[model samples]
Target: MTSSAFTESSLTGIPVKRGKVRDVYDFGDRLLFVATDRISAFDWILAPGIPDKGRVLTQISRFWFERFTTISNHLLSMDPADLPLPADTDLEALRGRCMVVRKTEVVPFECVVRGYLSGSGWKDYQATGAVCGIDLPAGLKQSDQLPEPLFTPATKAESGHDENVSFEVMSQAIGQELADSLREKSVQIYQQGSEYARERGIILADTKFEFGLLDGTPILIDEVLTPDSSRFWPAETYQPGGAQPSLDKQFVRDWLETTDWDKNSTPPVLPDQIVEKTREKYFEAYKMLTGEECTW
Candidate 1:
């Protein structure tokens, strides 16, 4: 995503925070969250971005925010017409990818729930036969479904990848009551998300969620079920014997894997076609899951 599409000068709200893809401006008791098209991988922001990536992610989050409202409290106030946007703001230009949400103090932990063996969980399992201190059955391979959904909490690292910790560690960091609530809520959200995606012919292998508290109540915050935050596998191509074809950034990761460049070193610039195809995949996931056109 080009920086030209979003300028700090154009945003007029109380400054709250900024992250890799979003610039959040506080609006009194609410927030204006802007999604940018910037792409990050291996914990590094690349030189180029896939156009419309932000919109796709935003649209996906909007869809889930609507779909999941019955399950939990989420930070979404999607009514553009009623929002207190700047007078000259291009509301239409930001369509499909922005939200005006309630400003809530974020919970200390990032609630991550994994249903399959992959990524860092897989790496940790391969090393210790356990994930977040939960032991798994022997001889399990990559992409294997767990006996039950696992609650893997991780420290919200400032930069680079977040580090996974056991449930005990989570309770130690946060209070026992909040920790218990986070784990239960995380699993419930994942189960609902996975089941919903399954009906759409996609496998929700895993996903990460962030939660914030409004008073004593927990509310979901940040992005939800976007390609940037979840792993999607096409149901038809999913096989337990091999690496499943993913619908997220697997294409980008695979391209990087074949290169000689170390992930820590300068990341090789993504090619034009790869960027285009990746962008399409993000849109495809949003479309198939929501059954709605990505209009931004």
Candidate 2:
């Protein structure tokens, strides 16, 4: 099946706010968030959506939510299965991924925790000798493991890119105690997630997580460990020298890089083959990491 094969229908009576990928509908004190098959890379939404991409993301999120809820608070209900759903709640259509979570006021910051040197962290370190605010050991190369994981937080931008803020800047913004707590929690969550993925033959090379305040306490909200919000590299092809072939959307990213399309401009529509390959990649990642069949 192709992206053209799955167009989203508006939820009955429920208003929605669509993001780059997910469509979020208000549900009183909670929210019903649905991940679509749309795929985005390099901050651009590419053409030819990945079939089952949304279901894969949702299943992964649900897995992590079940695994780590005891470690910290998350936006979950006791009976997630009974939440209000669409008329076509057929397991295949709704999948096992769609989430009906308690909505909280989203924090204005993105709590990024890194166990390795790569991505934006590498770029920032190469230029400024630091990542976010934490200074790093000299002579660190791309994909080099950090001595210890670090918490690098960034301010969530409204329109453009999110600016990486230092720990000091973060402290001043949200108070020292809360800042410290957020950083600690972020590192702990990353540690658990990274270990879990590693055992499943995937290197979760640093991912970002979001937290929100519910009744004055922080709870993990939004998607966690999805390809859209992460850098997933297959363990078999993993190499430390250069850019790794990722199970995420590197296929799309690579194609975009070979084109004349500027990153700042509108991205070109993806070819059918590229979209199909990307969809298979997402499905494979979900299966390998979770050890579960992509039923949807």
Candidate 3:
């Protein structure tokens, strides 16, 4: 299949917000979320996007949202035909890449759950034998599985890196009742996803979730369990002492690290080889988890 990329999207209605990869349109009681093919790394949206990435991410989230019936979510439908699209809208372009969902006041924290020692959690553990103020056992190596998944929250920053914050801090900022609820739900969702992925020969190391409130009820919002929001490693080659091969954006990050360009500047356009490989990784993760090929 030929690859197609959408760096940005323009709809008839004014966009309420534009994230690194999604363009959200307000529809009074609901929202229209369009997942573009735009890719981001080091907190910067790169020049070129991986092809069919939006469809892969959208479909994967749809698969999880349908299965997570134990909790409430913002998803209404993935079919563009169900959305209140503007007249003359390109339905074909939006198919499988857009969602119609209930609107809510989004929480200000990034609800993260870590099942393994890697990424920032690994760095924090190496520095203080703890992650997000929660102490762990001594001598845990990189990518080592934690005794159990930990709910480590972070402040949701609009720009720059998200700083890890303790549960106490989170409770103070969002109230003890709400903080406790978010933590419990985040961990539960992560556990469910990890088990499902493990059975499919993939390791869902960790994932971050975003939540919002609708009439004082917490609901899962944004993308869920997509490669862009989680670290997925192949179970066949799982090794704990070092960085494991991944089925996520680690490929792009590894290539970026080899360049002389500092992360602060505008990211360079990805070469064709890198873009294709990244697309394949995203598609592979979706296929492995969903047991179906991407329609796009």
State which candidate has the highest TM-score: 3
lDDT accuracy of residue 233 in candidate 1: 94
Q: Which lDDT values do the candidates have, in the order given?
A: 0.79, 0.77, 0.90
Each candidate: how many clashes?
0, 0, 0
Pitting candidate 1 against candidate 2, the one with the higher TM-score is 1
Per-residue error for 168 in candidate 3, Å, reads 0.9
What does the lDDT read for residue 94 in candidate 3?
81
* Candidate 2 ranges with C-alpha deviation above 4 Å: 2-9, 73-92
Q: After superposition, how far is residue 131 of candidate 3 from its true place, in Å?
A: 1.1
- Report the C-alpha lDDT of model 2 over 1-296, residue by residue, as the tens digit: 64343436366677888776787778788887777777777666667677778878888887788888644545464333466766655445555546878888787888887877888888888998877757888888887778888787778854457777788887997788877878888888888889989999988887888888888788888888878777888778777756788888867888888999978888888887888888888888899878887766
Q: What does the lDDT come to for candidate 2?
A: 0.77
Off by over 4 Å in 1: 1-16, 79-83
What TM-score would every model get versus the actual structure? 0.91, 0.90, 0.97
35 in model 1: Cα distance from truth in Å? 1.1
Q: What order do candidates take by TM-score, descending?
A: 3, 1, 2
lDDT of 3 by residue, 1-296 (tens): 38579767777755568888988888888888999999889999887888889989999999999999999999987776676667878887887889999999999999999999999899999999999889999988999999999999999987678888889999999999999999999999999999999999999999999999999999999999999999999999999999999999988999999999898888888999899989989989998999998767
Tell me model 3's lDDT, rounded to 2 decimals. Answer: 0.90
